[model samples]
Target: MFTLSDMWTFFLAFFLTLPLVTLVHEAGHVLAARAFGAKIKFTLGAGKTLFKIGPLEVKRLYFMDGWCQYESLKYDKLWVHIFIYISGSLSNLAVILVINFLIYQGTLPVHIFFYQFVYFSVYFIFFSLFPFKTGEGQPSDGLAIYEVIKYGKKADPID
Candidate 1:
């Protein structure tokens, strides 16, 4: 049986951890994209902005109603796109690895703290790899990459 305190702890831990995890994951994407010569934009949470930076241009609404768009010169090469897609998930995995290493090396507590951190990191990694699709009918990065590779440019398989 669970008590109110336990429920409160879970909620508090989840809310605290989710944003941190998301920021790190998104940072990974932003950094990798920039490294690969792509432009970037930033946003916070799901609500109207507390503030924004750069040019404030409106993008079309999708699953979430709207997203701030950052435009970059289109890259013809698939590798750049792949890198941008995979970087966020890779960053989350890196966090998981670092946390696990710290726990193993006795740098972090072994009980509740360790458990919650590990749980949050793992869930964050999963979500980054398989984000909810927008109403535009595009799959998440990982899924899109899989489809692109599987079907080639058309319905034909790549030789």
Candidate 2:
């Protein structure tokens, strides 16, 4: 019963909601990092300046490269690095749980709640398994490699 138009609508809605899910997900890392005494630089978003309040940073090609860089700190310790690395995914999962709770309590429509849950769940799993890289011109892919090298060993491999 799904037509091309229907599929397009689904994709459009999914993309539109992605930023919100991403912001909440990234905010998780920002909060966690701050809790551990790391200073957040900025949390950038994709396309046409949604609303910025801090320093003006360079606009990278990949939208997902938008990040909250911390103050100068040593990346020598694996545990600390791992914590920072995993915080974003943790935050996303937290959002999923909150949304799920709302859905359970009948506060959100089933369609909207389900869409958010699935969207965040996919992003969380993907990012957790493969983080966004900063350099090499492949920010998203590179992050995943960095994360895998840094924290993947601490947990099970994605595959």
Separately for all candidates shown, the number of backbone clashes (residues 3 or more apart, or on different chains) is 0, 6
Q: What's the lDDT of the predicted structure labeled candidate 2?
A: 0.56
Q: Rate the local accuracy (lDDT) of all candidates.
A: 0.57, 0.56
Where's the lowest-lDDT run of ten residues in candidate 1? 61-70
- For candidate 1, the clash count comes to 0
Residue-pair clash count for candidate 2:
6
Give me the displacement of residue 122 in model 1, in angstroms: 2.2
TM-score of 1: 0.71
Give every collision pair in model 1: none
| Residue 140, candidate 2: alpha-carbon lDDT | 45
Which ten contiguous residues of candidate 2 have the minimum total lDDT? 150-159
Candidate 1 structure lDDT: 0.57
TM-scores for every predicted model: 0.71, 0.63
Off by over 4 Å in 1: 53-76, 111-113, 135-138, 147-159
> How do the residues 27-137 of candidate 1 rate in per-residue lDDT, one tens digit apiece?
776677667555666443654454555632222211122222223525535666666667777887888788889888988767765566667667756754674665666
